[model samples]
Target: MDIPRSFRKTLLAHLPYAVNEDFTAADDLAALGLNSMGLVQLLTDLEETFGLELPDELITEETFATAGSLWATVSELVPAGQFSDA
Candidate 1:
């Protein structure tokens, strides 16, 4: 599966009203209504799904600002093509 797409799917699953909406890399999660609890859930899901641990320092407002930014952080820790199907 595509990492970002899977990420988006997981995010939408956690959100109450995001089922029909289209999400993009540039979309701001905060503006999309992701609160503290949602963020915590997202982090937990991301870690579990990707099998990677995020550093404390990387869990900043800016890091979760947008899908692209979050993907950048994930990519840094996960390495390229790790989640891409062969």
Candidate 2:
């Protein structure tokens, strides 16, 4: 599925560092210059964007590394009755 542009925009805004990285693809979260705070903010943005109830486990490096991966994870974790910011 084609991911929403809002997801990308929100992620970049919270990134607060080099906004030029190709975040659409899988890359190291640390390599993208995201510190712990940045990652927390990014998690908030993702939660708001997708309306997913995030667990602590979902906030790992692998799950949130890429826009595509993040969305997929959210889609999986977000339950049938879970809200979507649609």
RMSD in order of candidates: 2.9, 3.9
Residue range 1-85, candidate 2, lDDT tens digits: 5544555566677665546534555555566677888878888877776676788877787786766677677768656644333
What value of lDDT does candidate 1 attain over all alpha carbons?
0.76
Candidate 1: misplaced stretches above 4 Å?
1-3
Per-candidate clash tally: 0, 0
TM-scores vs. true structure, each candidate: 0.80, 0.64
Between which residue pairs do clashes occur in model 2? none
TM-score of structure candidate 2: 0.64
At residue 14, what lDDT does model 2 achieve?
Answer: 62
Give me candidate 1's TM-score against the actual structure. Answer: 0.80
lDDT of 1 by residue, 43-82 (tens): 9998998789999999999998876788788878876676
For model 2 the local lDDT of residue 44 reads: 82
